[model samples]
Target: MRYLPLTDSDRGDMLATIGVSDIDDLFVDVPAEARLSGPIEGLPTHASEMAVEKHMRRLSKKNLAAADAAFFCGAGAYRHHVPATVDHIIQRGEFLTAYTPYQPEIAQGTLQMLFEFQSQVAKLYGCAVANASMYDGSTACWEAVAMAGRVTKKKRVVLSGALHPHYAEVVKTMAKFTEDEIAGGLPSMQGSPDDAGLIERIDENTSCVVVQYPDILGRISDLTEIADAAHKKGALLIVVNTEPVALGAIKAPGEMGADIVVGEGQSIGVGLQFGGPYLGLFAVRDPKHVRQMPGRLCGETVDAEGKRGFVLTLSTREQHIRREKATSNICTNSGLCALAFSVHMTLLGEKGLRTLAAENHRLACLAADKLDAIPGVRVLNDAFFNEFTVVLERDARELVRDLAEDDILAGVSLGRLFPHEEALSGGLLVAVTETASEEDIDALCSAISENMA
Candidate 1:
């Protein structure tokens, strides 16, 4: 039976307090067409437990598991080799059920782990401070924009054309309520990203300039110039790194004059897991901006007995003591995912991470060369870390679907990302990692060649 938390009288009293005549009236802002008038058209609403289990098992078989295929579908989420130690460590009884470390005295272990996590992220991003974690990369990106707005008291946000379309959509969606002017358009397919064009869009009213490192098309650009342009216009430069592994080989965003550095921590310790539970890494290049940063910051301190201890240094969320003065309304963070990322990163250390990144790039280069050799196929980016885009003779969506039928998950199609944009129909984004073997690359290339031919 369904659980009803509120009685009719209780709901009526709340409705009266809010000046709403009824629950349906509360949904007045929602479009009439979007509201469901009746039950969905499908199979029966009731089913035996055993029958439902059988049906779910049947549906699960249709999914082509990433491990069972030559997977290369990293636009934002990546497929990486997570050490068994990471899983083993996070699944421990203590770490497994850990949530917010509200009572640091009793939650010392969790607090200390978070402290180390924040320190690792800050050093990795070349920033002064980092929060515990956030929901995911997209929400973290939006929070950075909101933080920038609070800092600069401006409402204009200029997005890089090559920024991930999903990230851009998240920013724009959140901007609708805030009424911030979003200035950007679809990324142009080219050898290099249009940094000059992005700079031109920034002005005095701009709050932040958002650019993705090794962007959606997998092209890498020096963000120094863009950062300088934003600073000159009194705007903060917010760098979004979808692939944190790239940082092991490339310059940290904070070092390139980014005021705020944010990214997905999935590449390090977290599995793609179809889609989330991914970790969002947020940090600030300058120490002054730490108070304005979202999520909680863990800090180390000395107790009354002169013993070492860790505590919640700063928590500006609505649930905390800040109340209305909170930096963000983000209630809880991805504690488990953050712990997983921390464990994976700790296992890799600095040198191991560099080696892992190098291998990914090596495999990616090999795959790009093999793909470029196929007639009517061209690698678009002049320089990239571990992922890049390619233009195909046929619609990439159709080609991708055809390859999937043969148990090969080729890559993500630009047409799928930008469905309404015809010009991007032939573009395909390919990602490579340590998990992809040389034989897998050959299989993907041969499949594409055969399909094109």
Candidate 2:
């Protein structure tokens, strides 16, 4: 029997108690133009669960999933192999059912996991400390910029043209409400930010200089020069990583003296569940800037008994206590995902992770070699980790669509992300993971060759 927790009368009574005539009044703040006039046009108003499931399955069958095709798409999110054990452990009733550990006494297990996760992230990025987790890489990036502004007490932020467009936009949106200035929304470098151009843009007014590792087109740069340039101008250097796996092979941003490091941790212990429920990894050098870092941090401390224990420390600086004076308003942490990431990292260990990253790079290089052999395709970047961009002879959007028709889930077309950049509109970014087999790469290469011919 179905349980009706709230009947129509109950809803009406609640609405009346709140001085609202109907439930729709609650949504009055939403613009009338934005509101749906009726139920979705083609969908049925109601259906039995079984019927809905069948219909959904039918609809799902019309599209190709990563497993169903030679998938190469990875602009930010990646398709990686998640071990069966990760799901099994995370689904434990104790861990899955628990909420935020506001009380450290009862939340020892949860808090400990976060502490470990933070430690792992700090080590991975070669930073002093890391928070539990943020919403995703993009938001973490925004928070990093805000933190830089606070620490430097400067208004201007220099964003590399090589930064991801979506990430750059998010930072810009946040800057709008702040007193900070953002300079250089330059075009993406496809491989790395134009270091020379970024260096040129830095000035005394700049608080931080931001650049991406293996940037939008998957090009890696030794930020020592850029970091030195920013530091010379009394500006902090913020490094972004859309793909965390690259860190295994490439130099850590912190090693090059990045004041702050932020990245998407989806490649590790996270699945590309259609772009979301991903983890954000943020780390910073040990300094006063720690107070400006967003999100909650779990610290290890001894209890009255002198045994090992975990507790929430430095919370007085958060939004609830500090109000407008708080460093950030981010109240929630990506707990479960963070736990999953911790578990995955623990299982992989340092050696396993590095091997996995090497495999991904190897496979990607192989795929790039094959694709570049195609008559109309030319690999753009000479240096990349697991992803690279290819310039197509024809429109990249059309090529992607044509390849998809053959059950090949090709790379992301540059036109899809940057519509106005004529030079890049015909480029497509392709990625390869350890999950992609040699056969998959060969199939994708064959599809592109046939299409181009």
Candidate 3:
């Protein structure tokens, strides 16, 4: 029999105590049109654990995972070799089951890991500080915009059209409730924006100008000039990156004078996992804006014995204490993923990450060169990190589908994301991670060459 914790009489009594005549009265705020009339189609009421597991396993076997194909698909999420050690360590009972440490004295280990993660993020981005972790790259972008607005006390934000379409949509969704102005400039598959046009949209009311690093099209940009322009108008420059691996080869956003830097840390340790459970890396310049930043931050401090200890520091912005007045309503962080990121980064260290990044660039350049040699295909950018776009003679979506049928996970189609842009409909955004080899690149090149011919 199904468990019903509260009986009908109990519910009615509770409703009457609250001055509601019936249980339906509690849902008065919900509109009738929006309410579901019946159970969802094709959904079972319940199932045995063993039966459910078997069904789920059968369903999961149908996916074309990176390991099953010659993978090259990276728009934001990437497939890279994750050390078995990372999984082993993160799965440890102490680290795996640990929740947010409310009591600082008892949760030193968790707090220290978070502290280290924050320090590593700050160093990588060349920013003053970093919070623990946020939902993912897209939500972190939204938080960065909100923080910029809080810090600058302004309402308008300008976004580069070269920004990832998903990231832009997240920012736009948040702006709707905040009643802030959002300006999205011209879209380009090259990933570099028409900075001059974006600059023209900035005004006194603008709080921040947001752009991506090695943006959606895989073009790296020097934001120093854009930062200067934003500062001239008393606005901040927020730089977003979907590929943190590029930081090892390209200049850090902070070096380019970006006021805030946010990116996905998935490439470092986290697997693609279809979509996520990925880590969002957020960092900012040292100033009073720390209080305005969202998420938890662990700071180094002293214990009763005067030895160094770590604790959840500067948490006034979270949900538990600040309530409605909090800077952000984001309560929990991506703890396990952040731990995985920290562990993998610790294993790679500085020089290893740089070498890995260089290898990625080398492979991507080789792929681009080989593909460009094909008839009816053209490489669009001279400057890129690990990814680049190619102009194709046919629809990129159809080409990708054809490539997939051959057991090759091809690149993303620009047209799939921006349907209205006729020019981008035939462009493909190809990515190459360290996991890709010479053989893989050749296979992709050969497939495209044969298809085009």
- TM of each candidate vs. truth: 0.88, 0.88, 0.89
True-structure Cα RMSD, model 1: 7.1
Clashes per prediction? 0, 6, 0
Q: Candidate 3's residue-wise lDDT over 1-453, tens digit each?
A: 144588778888888899979666778788988766677878877777788899999999898778878888888998889899999999998989877888878888899999999989999998999999998999999999999989899999999998899999999999999998898854755535567777887899999999988888888767888999999999999999998888889999998999999999998889999788988889997656788899999988999999898888787777888899888999888999999999999998999889989999999999999999999999987689999999999888889999999888779999877777887888898999988878888899889988875
lDDT of each: 0.91, 0.86, 0.88
lDDT of 1 by residue, 255-341 (tens): 999999999998888898778888999999999988788887788998889999998876544556777778888888888888888
Q: After superposition, which runs of candidate 3 have C-alpha atoms over 4 Å from their true positions?
A: 1-52, 189-192
- Candidate 2 TM-score to native: 0.88
State the local distance difference test value for candidate 3. 0.88
lDDT, residue 56, candidate 2: 89
Off by over 4 Å in 2: 1-59, 186-192
Residue 409 in candidate 3, Cα distance off native in Å:
1.2
- For model 2, state the Cα shift of residue 318 in Å: 0.8
Best-to-worst ranking by lDDT = 1, 3, 2
